[model samples]
Target: MGFWDFLKPRSKEHVEACWPGGKMLQVHMEYDTEKTIFTYFGRFGLTFNISKSQLTGAIVKEISRTHSVLQVYSGVDCVGTTDILPTEACNIMKDWLGQY
Candidate 1:
């Protein structure tokens, strides 16, 4: 990502991770009809974009009906971890695999 990219708007969405805490996390991927590429946004401050091939999607382990552990892997290593919506996790994985 470049500095000027910050000033520009791309295809994306903002997912509210915690509304009460005022913490927002974008674990969802929005479809870009123009580019036909799914973009993942969540990283605050500095946004980083890597090769789509590097992503292995997310592993969602359910802890309860409403909770799950979401771990995103880039290659063999985990790039991110958090407990969010399992359904959402599945959607993210689908995007990572370019199935959506």
Candidate 2:
């Protein structure tokens, strides 16, 4: 399965009860060579990273406990130049959010 598949939207009633104008995001990381999705509440200043995978990225929106997926934006490969790669998008998200 691809990433961002583990998260599910929360109930409408619950979302309506919370603050308005808040965005949502979900994240999934590889652990023991297996993917593990984890939901977290985040605003515009959250980030996380993984050294082994050499990934990084930031939360572009607010998320809820029901969020458990991530939409890749940018990333980099451990080999070759240090330039950002699509693979490192997840890492960038985590680093900016300090979720490492």
Candidate 3:
């Protein structure tokens, strides 16, 4: 198996291993609608947008989206990048895990 393939499942397993205190979250970005929504436990939900940055806070706790917009926010550093948007999803995920 490829390195990425091996790493992917191992990482996911690590996440799963940290459940209850942790969660499997789904973050959805609708390209057609320009909306972002988060789903948890396949039911609980929350949503966000670039315009509503204040309520979400300076650091996001987690994100699990299917779109590349998450990539656009990932690893970005600038007032324009972070002030208007939360930090990268991966950054949030790492922070969450470290809390454990």
Per-residue accuracy of model 1 over 1-100 as CA lDDT, tens digit each: 6557768974335321222112344444444444444344444542223344566665677777766655567888876554355555554554444453
Where model 1 places Cα greater than 4 Å from the true spot, the runs are 1-7, 11-27, 31-38, 42-49, 86-100
State residue 55's C-alpha deviation in candidate 2, in Å. Answer: 1.2
Which ranges in model 2 have alpha carbons more than 4 Å from their true place? 1-30, 33-54, 62-70, 76-99
Best TM-score goes to which candidate? 1
Per-prediction tally of clashes: 0, 24, 1
Residue pairs in clash, model 1: none
TM-score of 1: 0.44
User: At residue 79, what lDDT does model 3 achieve?
Assistant: 19
| Model 2 whole-model lDDT (C-alpha atoms) | 0.32
TM-score-better candidate, 1 vs 3: 1
Which stretches of candidate 3 lie above 4 Å from their native place? 1-24, 28-43, 51-100
The TM-score, computed over Cα atoms with residue i paired to residue i, of candidate 2 is 0.19
Prediction 3 global C-alpha lDDT: 0.28
Model 3 over residues 1-100: C-alpha lDDT tens digits?
3435424632222122212222334432221112222112212333333332322323332333421112223234321111112234435433433342
The global Cα lDDT (0 to 1) of model 1 is 0.49
